[model samples]
Target: MTVSLYVPLASPVHRAPAGLKLGLLAALAVALFVVDRPEVVGAALVVVVAVGLLVARLPARSLWAQVRPVWPWLVLLLLFHGVFTDWRTGAVTTLRLLALVVAAAVVTSSTRVTELVAVVEWLARPLAVFGVRPARVGLVIAMTLRFIPLIAERAHRIREAQAARGAARMRWGILVPLLIQVLRLATTLGEALDARGADAPVTPPRRRAGASTS
Candidate 1:
């Protein structure tokens, strides 16, 4: 279906280590949450924009499209914050949130689910002593990331179909069908997973695993 929104490509960012990018994201999130200074937030916003442009290679137009959906709600929050708090504070917080969102979008757009899953498993491997199954966790994460965009695309298609079929507005008539279609897709995905033995219990890797591969 020509899914280009967040699919991984052979870009520079894709070549970077996923764990490092995740660490950067975590640091940025912590900074956003703890810092109350507007100047600091603004600086962080600049860093996010610069990184997205240079490292992530996100063009201005695509950046705009990524943030376009959340913009209206951001405006509403800006108004509320300004009235409830102060214009300057509201503006700063709103801008900080936007920067965080953009950073997240850039990371997801650049990183592949396979890379993300591998990172997850590698990170969690040491915790196996506590009975954690990193491979299973990685598989769950992979499936979630993989299907989320697919579900979104299907929903978009359903919405477009309803509109074409003379849906006046987003009434229950349109929403009910969309929900049903989403559920159907989810069921199909679940069935496919079952068929693939994805829900099976995870066992420890066999000793001499290279023997099988060889």
Candidate 2:
């Protein structure tokens, strides 16, 4: 049942409206780019950490697991900035990236995929005049979000199997098989969608502009 990173914790963050959380994330991202000061970035990170620990009430281990996959990328970014640019800039950028990723993890951890899809659909409704079907867009976003964790799990399993076979250094070896598996999964999903009458679409219920705070 726990297909994604969502933790069923009863907290204010979990009860807060997803739309507002998303908006806050967006605002923080903009601030990160526009504000160049390390002090500001540090302050933002303090807030992020506070929310993650005190507000979300997530266990330290669970929070670490949620952000573990991105550590390499974060390190790479830090190293690149530190080498080519200045150490202060590198540190600030690293903090910015970490804050952004953690904010997203917090949102996804609290919100359900279906609720996120609905929120996205509500936002995308105006694009209907541009010939985009809101329902289809929502479905696409929902499936993409859902499959992300699934693919990550698959990749982990493949890596473990390769390690067990003494092919620990064969990182690239996982690529071809992973791609093929992803394609097969996509095909299966498409078939299942068709069977569910996705093509014979009816009007989707209009999503409320305001998200549920409960």
Candidate 3:
């Protein structure tokens, strides 16, 4: 089961270039990380959310729903940061990551995964000069984007199945089976790729030895 965060709303944000959205998201992420002041990050979070909601035309309910699933992790982050660092620092870090997550959600919801992969391939084109394959990078990006929702859905179903079987309390047991399930899925994917031409080994370019004077 794939979890779709996309809201089909005709808005400028939705029509914006995937490359531009990705770049802006990257810049904002760096800015949030670089500026550690809680006030600044908190304010930035507000702007990010507003852009995601108002500018991106994402329904407020949908935006909040995407964020809702992250509360447990967010709490853990704050607790860890607070225990080791100051509360202000913790708040700054928490808000910074939350802002990035919201920003990414906005981008992903608006843009198609194929568009993003094309942008990545374009961005990584220069690497081809150094014997690197940009298509591989694009393929990895596409696979990652495709797999995130699937993996999450699988984990959810696994938890539900365990609960139904009276093993709800055995979280550790669920982990083992879930991991094995994921590994099996990976193996199947690998086999499919092998059936295609993607299994070919990509050898690195060898460095030439410098001229030696006898």
Candidate 4:
């Protein structure tokens, strides 16, 4: 089964406007970096957890699934900082990253794909002056989010196949087949998009010189 990042729920977080959620996320990211104190970051992390669990009402498993793949990297980050710098720095840095990741997972779980795409398209509207297609940009964002879980699923399947073949341990050899599969999928998707005229150029709206475009 293909696992989608967006969870279906009627919670307040889920009903919040996508743009508002994204804006708050951006603010949270900036605040976390600006305040380097571990206590502040820890407090922010607590708030994030409360929002996800209590406000969003998301199952802990859903949040864990998002964080599980990155725990190894987080461990490595802590070890690296602890070795060169200090344990306090390591703890703060690790917690900062963990908070960001979980916060992002919360946003994705609450927001629908279409809602996200619409927000992206709206944000990209100004770039249309430079011949950028907002719709295409939105499509790219949508595809990126959609593909993350799909690629992870494919890698899991490849690992299972390797294990079934009596491979004693996971090896780098899986990358070869995984790459091939990804390339094939991309080619098929591209062909389908072309058939649907997704590559067609969009015409920009005309604006009068005496009026404000905004």
- 1-214 per-residue lDDT for model 3 (tens digits): 3445677778999999999998999899889878988899999989988888888888878777778888898899899989987788779878988998898888888887678769979988998999778888877777887888888888889899989999878767777878888888887897687678685785554556995422
Please give the lDDT score for candidate 2.
Answer: 0.83
From the highest TM-score down, the ranking of the candidates is 4, 2, 1, 3
Off by over 4 Å in 2: 139-214
Clash pairs, candidate 4, are: none
On TM-score, the stronger of 1 and 3 is 1
Ranking, lDDT, top scorer first: 4, 2, 3, 1
Candidate 3 has an lDDT of: 0.83
TM-score of each: 0.61, 0.65, 0.60, 0.67
Q: What's the lDDT for residue 21 in model 3?
A: 93
State residue 156's C-alpha deviation in candidate 1, in Å.
14
lDDT string for model 2 (1-214, tens) is 3366778899999888888989988998998899888889888888887898899987767777878988998899889989999788888888888888787778888776677778889899999999888999978876776778888889999999999999999969999889989988886887698779886765555667885522
List the pairs of residues colliding in candidate 1.
none
What is the number of backbone collisions in each predicted candidate, taken in the order shown?
0, 0, 0, 0
Worst 10 residues of 1 by lDDT: 205-214
- Candidate 1, residues 107-133, lDDT tens digits: the string is 877787667778879989999999888
Tell me the deviation in Å of residue 136 in model 4: 4.2
> Which portions of model 3 show Cα errors greater than 4 Å?
1-4, 132-214
lDDT of 4 by residue, 1-214 (tens): 3356999999999999999999999999998888888888898899998999999999999998998999998899899999999988888888898899999999999998789889979999999999988989988887887798899989999999999999748688689999989988997998698778896764454457894422
lDDT of 2 at 19: 89
In order, candidate lDDTs are 0.78, 0.83, 0.83, 0.89
